[model samples]
Target: MKIAINGFGRIGRTILRQILTTARGSGIQVLCINDIAEPEMCAYLFQYDSTFGPFPGQVALETGALVVDGRRIPLHQQANVTALDLSGADVLLDCTGIARSTDLAERGLSAGATKVLISGPSPAAEATVVYGVNTKDIKGARIVSNASCTTNAVAALVQLVDQVAGIDSGHMTTIHCYTNSQPMVDAPRGDFARSRGGAQSMVPTTTSAMHLIDVVLPHLRGRISGAAVRVPTASVSAVDLVARLNTPLAEADLMVALRAAADRSPVLGWTDQPLVSSDLRARPESLVIAAPETRIVDSRQLRIFGWYDNEWGFSARMLDVAAKMAEAD
Candidate 1:
């Protein structure tokens, strides 16, 4: 699968790193990159990422190209989608966060992409997929949205519990790390709370995951609702989910059932280690259940906590989805 990244921010850079390391020789390769920054800045940022440490391999800048591991991927500084040369790319991964319309997204196809997989939620997407949970529902859509990071984390767990224990209703609060969307210090942005500082406070906000989950898990349409709290952190996030199950059970029993399901799941992970969010900074799993933190109250009330490196996990899944789209194409 040939990939073209449209943004070179946290998500975009990490996607390239995953392709070079964990996804190496897996038939997925980055063919080109498009960003507003110059090629020199792109190479510098990719080489020394403060969150994930160094790139591990060499990253050098050439004329209009970024060299990684001795391979030069063509780099384009095109702010307009029509100017991007995705000549041989099978999938154009839109990490720009601005491709919110079908007209903007479809322009990639005209530029040469066989399919366009958006990194964030898009009203224009023919399908909003959560990869491991609802990849089977893709059905060969030409334009697909991978949905949000929180959506991917929560949806996987929700499906697992609903299938294993049966969920009557649930609520999720993603203790997510602040993203580029928020400001570093107080500023006059559109939203009131978001105007206050991203790293300066624990700002409460809404998440689109609640709505996207319904698209991925249709039966649980009205069964689940979600919100998010942006904490002061660079990477790694947690999901604090509470559910009322149809069948009541002990805490131990629920753990056993969920673990078994995660064992069979593609993106879900299981970790019993006593660790904090910093420990999971670079974890590739979509959601790793912190076993000991899970508890049951009144036999029916369930609380579960799962961790994820939001940037890395989402990037990994996007690549996986892009590959699936390529196969169907």
Candidate 2:
């Protein structure tokens, strides 16, 4: 499987590193990378990630090609998706986040790519997949979107709870870490609150996790609401989820269900040990349930807290989705 990366930001680089290290035997190859950044800058960023530490393998640029651990991949400085040569790519991972329309997404297909996977939520996606929750529904879809980190975190727990006790209604509050979208210093922008310095304050913002969740779990449409606040942090975020259940469940029973789900699903993780947000860095699972923070009230309402390394975990799931799509082909 020849993969082409459309963006070289945090998620794009993470996915490249992940493929170089783990997907070697799966026949997955990163044939080319497309980004607006200069080749040297992208190579530099790939070699040194502040959040994930230095790259496990060396990276070098040779004749306008990127050599990662001895594999030379072409680097293209192109921003227009339709203008690129994608004849050899089996999958094009659009980590750009800017391609939100069906017309934009079709550019990859029109350019001769077999499939295109968007790294984040998009209205143009044929199907929005959450690895553990709804990947079974992605049967050879040409365009797929791996919702968002928050959606992945919330959907895993919600699906587990719904399977065990049945959810009546729910709400999720994601205490998220700052992203590249936020400004480092106060600046003029359309959204006044987000334009403020990101590292200096906690800013409440809207999240599309709820709507994307409905895309994956259509049965839960209009049953969930969500909000997010970006805090001053480089990595790790928490999701505070509350759900009302139709079937009453004991706390112990809920724990048992979560443990079973964790064992069965690759995307769900359960931890009883006391852990802070920093403890979850580099974790590949979509969400790690903080068992210590699990609580139930009157055997009907449930509260669960989950921690996720948004960039790493979400990118990992994107690779998983890409691999699954490859298999389907």
Candidate 3:
């Protein structure tokens, strides 16, 4: 059950740490990292340091790779996925978010991997998984995509509502954090032509999270819409939701239903008191189902709020999904 990692940035490093520390036994002997950055920088980032917080075990920096609990993982310096030697791994985790699923998945399959899972969304995935919602559908998927953080949270909300109160329709606004792709200061960048020079400012853009949520929660498929705004913050974000309910539910009943749903969904949690984005980020869970300060503008509509750690929490869930894929194979 050996595994290979394609990127070593924030999500990539977090995946590496999760795989090595978990007792689930991924048997990830060789970590073939394909990144443009220098190999030593990747090693430095993956190497565990107690200064940040507590680690499950010690991580040592060996000659040219990282060692954890006596397993020495060889880090290949190759930048091209096709050129790398992946003959030993059973699965490959594509954390690069490059959206080259067809090429990378074919490369891994050619290299003798049983399956490949992408941490971010990919158009070629057999199905997009949202853990508690559609993980059962991934029993034999060859290639899978764990939806984005915003998608995960929104999907959880939709599933809970659809199961309990019943949803007529909904919309989401994801206030996300800055990513590594964005410049620290205002400068010309890629994508939106008008967004070329405003990395430091709030950039209103569209998010496919709502569109992709249907891949997991088919009941709400095409029934919801979403938009995104990139804030200056680095890690935490919140999802503001507005929904048309099938039946009017009292605030107390809705809160109880949400908490019950959270208890069922390990990644989804509930918080009663008022909380900021930073407070929910510290919960150490993939998704938190905070009972929103709900209000009914009319007889059949309700609104909710949810928060998540765009990188750490959601990325951790990606690692969990990848691990499950390895175990099933």
**TM-score for each of the candidates:** 0.97, 0.96, 0.87
lDDT of 3 by residue, 102-129 (tens): 8765666666667787887888787789
The number of residue pairs in model 1 that clash at the backbone is 0
Off by over 4 Å in 2: 23-26
Of the candidates numbered 2 and 3, which has the greater TM-score value? 2
Worst 10 residues of 3 by lDDT: 46-55
Candidate 2 residue-wise lDDT, 267-308, digit = tens: 888899999889999888899998999999999999999899
Evaluate candidate 2 by giving its C-alpha RMSD to the native, one decimal.
1.5
**Model 2 TM-score?**
0.96
Model 1 poorest ten-residue lDDT run:
22-31
Rank order (by TM-score, best first):
1, 2, 3
Sort order, lDDT high to low? 1, 2, 3
